[model samples]
Target: MSEHPIELSTRMIDTGVVDTPSNRVTEELSELADGVAIVESFSHVVAVRTDDGLVAFDSSGSGSGAQVVEALRRWDDDPVHSIVYTHGHLDHVGGSAAFAADAEDRGRPRPRVVGHERILDRFERYELTSGYNRMINMRQFGGAARSARRLDERPFLPDATLRPDVTYEDHRTETIGGVEIEMHHCEGETDDHTWSYLPGFDMISAGDQFIWNFPNCGNPQKVQRYPVEWAESLRAMAAKGAELFVPAHGLPIAGRDRIRTCLETVATTLEDLVADVIEAMNAGAVLDEILHTVTVPDEALDLPYLQPLYDEPEFVVRNIWRLYGGWYDGNPARLKPAPDATVGAEVVDLAGGIDRVIERARATSTAGDHRLACHLIEFAVAADPSSPAVHEARRAIYAARRGGETSLMAKGIFKSAEADSTTVIDGEAPPLRMIRDLGD
Candidate 1:
């Protein structure tokens, strides 16, 4: 791997070369300014030395949270005065326990945990939908989902999540260790997102708002994301004229001009997407038509930071429709549609038999129409679940779909489908059962 593994890896995955100047990640503590430093863990943690003590932003992911604390100790042993959570996502806030434990070990006061007021609601929802989150995450991150599971068998959001002791509704300014820190709430990847700015150092800790990849405004497996407001928030941060930009998931950026251009470009890409999507929705375009019509400019997509690595633009279009147009996809037939298996049985009968349907699915996949091939193969599988040929075709089609995907979320979902077909072919237990067992 190259020194900047993420940039090198992305180049290989996106353009088959290592030339683009992508986000740089370093294992050691990197100082962004006089008092600001960052530890690049699974999710980076930002630390600011204040007159009273140290103010930290985020604690990395749960598995690496303790390690992050250790790394920070190596750099500076100032007792943590406060920790600000940018959001309630597991990766950003799941490591609070380690921070708390560190405080106790050092005989220091428990660091005050602060975050958006909606953070409590997010944690409550996570508890309520633990199983669903586990399933979705399994299909979103593939095999790595196993490590994300908590000891309590819940995956993604763990039971150890630390709720904010101090909550702010839209904006809050705190003088921590004599350093003024401003927290501004915005709806982006999560409703409970907070971006912090320090005027003393002219630095912005942008949580996940400026993750190096395309803005993750369209996560297919998760809740609704605010793209319109997300863009607006980025613009707000850009107007701050911060000299150093630090994101929760990627390397820190220095230089005011470089930071401003990056922020504006991301904002413009999302702004264009939201505008096109809302325009199509107002014109009464259906979801499918809207998806085809609203598109991010190819020039924007070509930007290294805007590449679709974690989430794609097409998914964002669907999210926009969902936000504005409701669940009805404008297809009357699907309003009160029959069960998928029942519809598949009808299609299989119309196509003669399962074998014939499988043959056509294989041909379609061979012709590079994997989407249509998967649709046909799904019907064949539903029509005759016991057919080995149908299962083989289903597996092959989904594998092809997985191979063509750019986003990790898309690939994981396709891989899950392929895994299901393999489970049936190998005479193993159902995929859901396996997932449940893994959680246990």
Candidate 2:
């Protein structure tokens, strides 16, 4: 098992040292300035001490919340005056209940919860699609069916989520404990993302906008992200010229020039991608053609921070097409196409038989054409799902695909597919696995 909560084969992006410790297990609490400190949890929680009380940005994820609160208490026992959420992502706001509970125990009044008004809508959506979210998350994280089933038994949105008591439209400035925080709302990873700036400290708390890795504007399973506006928001942050930059997911960065370069490079990457896709659209190019043609420059990709470790640029191009072009993929036949199973059956018939199709899939996989291999295997399974030979081959092919994938999202989904094939071969109830001793 990896030491980091989020594991990646790639090396950590090379951002200048801002004093983040190597030991993430201990939750290093680094004091950036006189009254400011950051608790480096899965997602960081920033605490700013003011004359009146403590003002915190993000509570961290569910169980991590209590740990963050304890870390903050160790630094200073000031009552939390307010909690500002950067967005509605569970990791950012799940810990709100812990902060509230700590305040109550200390005999202090409830801290004001502030966020973009759309956060309420996000929570409501989660409630409505709890089952669907669980299934996708299982695929997203490559967890077993038992894990997803456990999640289904509970509420998707935690009861501990402290909804925003105060909401804003575009921007708002609040004075908490004599410290002023300027919150600016913009469309990015989520519609409700807010980037806060503290004039007194010359610091900017960029929610998910400036995470150390590549910008997550192209999550495959998530709702629509704003690439065009995401670029605009980054440009706006670069213009702030803040000395200290605090991101929700990564270590804090100090120095104006380093911060500006990081922000501008990310902005330019998004802007160029958007422009290239838009140009292809104007030429009446189809979705597949656009995806193949539009590309991020090598200079941008070479930037350690802009690496495609989480969400790649290809997914972002598809998102732009979805935003502007709607669901039609410029292919009339697909507008109201037959079900995939029906199409697969027909393809199998034309390809001769299930055995032939499986053979072709293995050859395609060996030849480094995993995408074509997947299509062939899908047809084989759909046409003859009862065939033990086909299922075994399907499992092997999917495992190979998973091994070759770079993005966690792709790997997780491929792993899920491999697991599904294993279930069929083992003759277990769909999604159920037989347990074995560890040493076995």
On lDDT, the candidate that comes out on top is 1
Q: What is the TM-score (0 to 1) of candidate 1?
A: 0.91
lDDT of candidate model 1 versus the reference: 0.81
Per TM-score, the best of the predicted structures is 1
Model 2 clashing residue pairs (backbone): none
Quality of model 2 by C-alpha lDDT: 0.80
Q: Which portions of model 2 show Cα errors greater than 4 Å?
A: 1-26, 143-151, 429-440
Candidate 2 residue lDDT tens string, 1-440 = 22332221122334433233322445657788889888888788988988988889999988799999998999999789889999998888989989989988978887889999999999999999887777777777763444345545667678878999999999999887678899999998999999999999999999899776667887878999998899899899989999888888765667787778788889988988898899999998999899888888776765656666667888888899998898798998899987555676789899887788999999999888888899899887766665678878888888888888766777877888777777767775434232211112
**C-alpha TM-scores of all predictions:** 0.91, 0.90
